[model samples]
Target: MNTNTACELKWGMLCAALIFLLLGACSDKDAIDTRPSYDPSKPVTISRFAPDSGGVNTQMIIYGSNFGSDTSQIKVYINGHLARLIGVNGTALYVLVPSKAGTGEVKVVIGNPAKEVVAAGPFKYIFLPSVSTLAGFTDKDGRTAIVDGPIEKAQFEEPYWLCFDEKKNIYVLEEFRGMRFIDADKTQVSTRFRTGNGLDRPRTLSFNTTYDTLYITNDQGSWTGLSTAVATKADNFTRWTSLIYSLQTNGGAAQPQTGDYFYNSYSNGAIFKWDRVAKVSKELFRIGDVSWEFNIQFAPSGDFAYIVVVNQHYILKANFNRETRQLETPVHFVGGRRSAGYQDGVGIDARFDQPHQGAFDENDNFYVCDIFNHCIRKITPEGVVSTFAGRPRTYGYADGALRDAQFDRPMGIIYDKESGTFYVADQKNRRIRIISTE
Candidate 1:
């Protein structure tokens, strides 16, 4: 009971009390949350978004107010196309742009009852290239006919070649059937010509610069001597006039410039320049044997010409001499000769299975319809080959986003620079598919 003993006991009791208080405070499980609480009554607001313009799959962050942390209750749309909600924190939302979300407004809907908020300005969505069926039955029942009318009711059998006239009207050559016409609106299809006398087994077609004349090649045997013919708009494309009757098997044709009509003969694998006015043909170059089926295409600038040797599974690149107006001896550009498979690489490292027809875009990128591979290929100016649309060797009838789309034996393709669109002739599927940015 001494003074020193009492002072020590009081100090020890106070210290123990202080430690217990500290432990109690530290052991408390409930922690303070700094997040702003979401109120159901408050309206959701979208103030703005970063990188307002972006293509499909672009991860965009939207800044706003009164957004709940629960993403399940939130939905975002660009141009009326639903976007995938990735994450949401009360004040911010993360979303991925969906396909076909063209330039348009951004809308956000939140809460159980749904409070909608539209951004003050459009998101300026960028379009990603996608493939969709322009025409044809998507069923794989092997049913095909020549019935033509509105796009939905229209039918095609073995559509091979597609060409666009000056009026943007499309001409499709069917194997057994003759010619099918598609109006610019893409709303209707009509039988322009039927397989008969001057035009049997039409193989390929091309329109003159003026689109007044259409040249179509026939697949009759070389001995038939009636493979090259022309149909004019003046005749309503009803009759074909025999341009020549040589022993060579005509495969395809192209008009490199205003007055130059060049065609390939499969029998000799020789390309011939035909003066449409005089009907005289001159040899340009020969690259293969009798087994080759060639499709010719010129670059947008006419500086390069590509020969897609169908059976050979390779592309030959030739330099077009602007001054002399002649194609130089072609060199192996992309794909491997006789070495066929589904592969993507640069130059000869690439592979193709029955690469048929191709067209050059405004950017000079060449797109080829790889028939047996069942895909469309893109070849850059640097000779880089990649699958632009359709899965390799996977054939069927499907319409959707480019990579997700399917095609069967696509035989020909042409690009429309005006609209940045590509038209594909899905041969075995008996349909015309289109690839566009919109």
Candidate 2:
């Protein structure tokens, strides 16, 4: 062969060798494992895992024997919550820590019939706080009904307002459906009262200092008519009487720990102190010429009151004079008056869209239901405003981690100090959503 011919032959041979190597590599990658399948009779065991502790979605590995190569057959659980199995080899199984998997033992189960093995050490599950549905249907189809029994089977037409009794039992005011009582254990919900009579168009509600009487706000659609009604546990909440009236339509009421009751005038922005003994009301303070449906919330210390100006899109902070039983001059605490939008900042820098109601934690941290914004707003004691949960401008029914959760026009929110949970009246969604630190 000539020089060029010899070069072509050598090139052809090198090309043939490269092709063979590529084919070999592909075959090695795609080849099925010929190793004998793991036998359940060998007994599954979890000797140890890397990192030992993790949060949701944290990848963990279990090293042991008889875990089987089939990912479907290998199940891992951290603190009783199932961990997602990513992949598995005979000796090690890879998994992602599941949400709400608190610190606890790590168990591994294998085989179809299932044999379990737990790690020698418990796994400390570090997870971010999440928002979950505590009550009502989670579907986004806008379900509205009044059914009460077990919590899982209970339903609400529209959870308009909520308050807790001394026993920690939750009293939820259903718009157009009257009142619902959720037992302290959260296992059952029952209709404490049916609508009609004086309990019409229930907008907000609260328990008296004794917790035996439930006061609810009812918008009478007139400037002067029945606005607040009450039902006592003595009567089993079967009937309600007009507690305070002739104020305005679409107002809210709050009973402070000091054993005093106050309601707002939705038309003129006046806070009235109701004297239950005399069955009368006296104007405590007025927020200038403002005219809108609003709600009131007292600080944990009772030294201040937050006025949620519904259509004005801002919150007013008023000094509470315990001796005089009145609120001092009102000033903007956060958000802009009549300036509606979604923004988070300090004081006036933050914005809210049609803020409706708020609740306070033990630390005086205020949480407001920013209705039109479709989210909950947290106003720190320092006046720092931030989105606590739910995506602003996004509306739907979702219950999961906070970042993925959504709400449609939440109308009310109440914080339970015992559980550090905030129950939300997801108005348009027609369900109650909760945010709790897990």
Candidate 3:
């Protein structure tokens, strides 16, 4: 063993050691995160519910983390009531919230089979509840709604439409004027956002379920004429003020301008969109005369819209394209020239004449207001129509009894799942009627 041999051996050993250390640092284990970590403290947003039109079965959006691709292991507990996860994508969930009141806390529990790398903690769902109903259903003292109290007498009219925004404020639309917001307390209406200036009779409205857009259709106005038209007052988005959007001010058309509008009925043939926020509108479809667009409803997904052409005739689903900015042809869904009457219950094509508004069951089955037939008609998503209530023969107002069911022109409709009550806007009867369907 010479000195030269010993030195060579030492250098060789040092170089080999250095190579080994470098290889260890570049190992695959260091590059790949095979196990997932669940940090409950980091705060995973499990679910979020927005303010609604104060109806039952309000929809909600949910997000979850540490949840594997298999969704069976994740269970959402809203107020202790288990909600059915409509769709599960990765850790995100789209759920229909159980009506609040049982419990105030929202709990997200990872199933036993949940493969976790870290401990998971539940996040409290600070749900913003919505209150729409007044104390009673009576027009007490002609000032307060039966459910909501203390509404000014001036606010009462042919019944202004009530809607809600993403922020939860209610919007009230009047025919001649414009739209305004009603606070959650149901006490005061903010005229700050009024979109009426040259509008004739702002009546019906449809709020895009997924966005900040709104469609307002005025039934009629004195501004309408042969040529020299007048435009209705819309929320002055350009000026961010309450000024009316009349051409007289901008020198475009006339006071009440009619560009994409058509010759339709007063409350029947309705302008499809006419959004207040977008500051533009297009003709959705046309109907014969008054009581048209009676029982209109949007697609559950809000991708399309439907209208029950009453008095004039025809039932069609209006398709719209935001990109092309045109309302394509309308698909005739239901309605006949003989179609008449829009009262209570689900109004069917064969059995329904003048159908008003409609309500949906958990299955998305539309319950139409078969006004003329004096009964309710059920129409499935496939367009299959049937009878659910409001039989013209042997119909009377009985407690949960199928017989003796009488509805005098049932108009507007909303279902209250909590109390099993079906609220009806009995227009001709000049009162809102309630029948428990649950």
Candidate 4:
């Protein structure tokens, strides 16, 4: 062949060889080892684990070698249950302890090849004890004791009333402190709101769950909102004593909205419904010649409201017509005449001496703080009255069995459903007393 022809053939051959070499390089790269390999001599090993003991859903870290960074290829088991792997690195893995996992060995599996490694010691699953009853409260040593303070900073000076919101935060009415908010744990305290408007001597607070509004009654005879950001004010009462919100009506144009609230005037013995939207107060009904209304609470059924007649030493169960905004005749449910004594029986047979505040438990059982009698009393849904806490006629700061425990004029009382505990504002003791079976 001519020199030019030979040069062209050589160029084509060189191009073919170049293509073959490129194909080989691509194949080698595609076949590169992606699967992690384990050595029999230097197998996967777990050195230790941080926070080897924790409750369910708690995150823990595992320290080891040959864990491999691929999360999907790794599995972690706490006590036989597979733990959720949150992250994984070559030498460590993070996981959440599985719910219902018991205390046992923690195993880490590296890959489908199944190189398993276990820590030196087993991990522990912490299960919190369940509270069974509200019979009494005790300390770590199992001795009867008060759970909350007399700490100077958290002490209350005549805490008149208290109520819990949906979040379980407590709103307390301190005679001098205006309104204070205590967290569920009671570890932190905060002021719910502050306003230049007279909230002096706030006596009672009622929360409207539907509107998230708080209706407060003070000695100044004014109804105000907890937050100044909201417009809630109704003045001109002789003396506002107790406050509570009406239940929401499902049907009927004439029925009051869920935001409406009611308060009783101590001086006039009149109950007034305050329209939250219109910011107006209208008298609903008046108890004949009755004086010193202390506490008012609506039953969960929303059929009737129980009012404490402080001077009468009885609880009046008043039925209200949501459509007409009128209250029917009130009945003395728990006590009889104005005589003050310590006695437990059915309905009118029971006696109360200066009952202050009242609350209801999950079972609809009504509880009252019989201040003068120095005990907490419970009135069943069937109208059977009994002393639930505090020794009758016994007054001190001692804590023990209901019959042996002494309370110094316990006032504000509230029930916490979350903990199944009753928190009492032991007014004379200047401390909060809790009753529970935790």
Clashes of each: 0, 0, 52, 0
Instruction: Give per-residue lDDT, candidate 4, residue 30.
Output: 55
Per-residue lDDT of model 2, residues 25-112, tens digit only: 2425577854335696788777888667767666676778886566667678888988877566567776777766789999988887
Model 3's alpha-carbon lDDT is 0.45
Report the lDDT tens digits of candidate 1 across residue range 1-438.
999997687556544544532343342358764445568877788888765887766667778888766667779988898998766667777777776678888999887687888998888867767887888874556887887788988988888888777778888888778888999878999988888775667787877767778778876765556778888889999888898676455465554475467777777788877776676888887898775777777776767778888888899988877676667789999999999999999999999998887878767888899988899999998999999999889998788889899999998787777567789999888888888853
Highest lDDT, which number?
A: 1
Which residue segments of model 2 deviate by more than 4 Å? 1-125, 138-141, 252-255
Q: Please give each candidate's TM-score.
A: 0.71, 0.71, 0.46, 0.59
Model 1 has an lDDT value of: 0.79
- Model 4 misplaced regions, further than 4 Å: 1-153, 193-197, 221-257
Better of 1 and 2 by lDDT: 1
lDDT of 4 by residue, 1-438 (tens): 999997687556544544533343233555773433334457798898767687665667777777655677788998899998766555667777876688999998776657787888999888652212212233455344222342324545555577776677676666655555677656665555432344444666665545245556555542332211121223211123333322111001111244446666665667666665676657766764634554567776566778787767888887767786555667778886677888999989999998878878878898899998999899998899998888898887676666667788888888866445677877766556777522
Model 4 pairs whose backbones collide: none
Q: Model 1: runs farther than 4 Å from truth?
A: 1-120, 138-140
Candidate models: Cα lDDT each: 0.79, 0.77, 0.45, 0.64
lDDT of 3 by residue, 1-438 (tens): 999997687556544544543343343755773334344445444433322122234444444554433346666666576765554444444455554424344456665533223113322333332212321222544433222234442232333344444454545443344544456544554453334343445545444334233445444333342211222225321112222232111011100111222223344354434344664544555544444444345544433455665554445665545465444566767555554543232223454566655766666677666665656666776677766665563333332343345655554555544445455544333333445454
Q: What's model 2's TM-score?
A: 0.71
Model 1 quality (TM-score): 0.71
